[model samples]
Target: MAEMTQITPFVNCRDLAAQRRFFEDMLGFTCGFQADNYAFLRRDNVAVRLLEVDFNLDDPARQQMVYIDVDDVDALWAELEPALSKLPEGRARAPFNQPYNQREFHVSDEGACLFLFGQGIEPSA
Candidate 1:
């Protein structure tokens, strides 16, 4: 059997420049490669690809969600809190424990892609 190496998600956004900024400035991802309509961003081991697309933002079907597993969700959230606070209300959420045995922090980018950062925790008693 071939061993799977890594998985990178391709995200569609209305504005590539703004999306790139969100990934880099907000999420701490560095741009590995970029073109007129596409960009490859990486932070530590995770990677994401941003593609410029013409899509209806009003359509709920066009929204995307990406879940990222982290070693420490709270630490990551603290580092991003200052920047996240500048976003409009409801764009960022504080880290919280979930019934699923994970602590998660949720944030939405300018393109409305929801990114969830989570860390595994002991199951609640």
Candidate 2:
């Protein structure tokens, strides 16, 4: 079988610049490469590519979601809360352990992509 290589999501957003700004300033992705209509960004070991498109707010498309497994959810929240809270709807939902056994919170970036940062829930004492 052919060896499987990297799989990076190519996101389509309304504004490329806004998406770049959000990923850089808000989500901490560094632009590794760029072109007229697209950019490749990376943070740590994760990579994502963004493409500019005429996105419709009313389009019944599957929402884009990114799950970031973090070591300290609380610390990440504290660092980002102040900036996130200022967005029109960028408020980060308080972290809660899910039924699937993960503690996570959701934050929406400028392009309306939902990012869920999570950690494994500790067992009750």
The RMSD of every model to the true structure, in order and in angstroms, is: 0.9, 2.5
Model 2 lDDT per residue over 1-125, tens place = 89975667877788899889988877778998999999999987778899887757336574577788888888888877776776675356878878787888898765647788999986654
Candidate 2: worst-modelled 10 consecutive residues by lDDT = 54-63
Model 2 ranges off by over 4 Å: 1-7, 55-57, 123-125
Clashes in model 1: which pairs?
none
Per residue, candidate 1 scores C-alpha lDDT tens digits across 1-125 of 99987889998888999999988888889999999999999999999999998878658888889999999999999999988888889999999999999999999988858999999999988
Candidate 1 is scored at a TM of 0.95
* TM-score for all models, in order of appearance: 0.95, 0.82
The candidate that wins on lDDT is: 1
Q: How accurate locally, in lDDT, is each candidate?
A: 0.92, 0.79
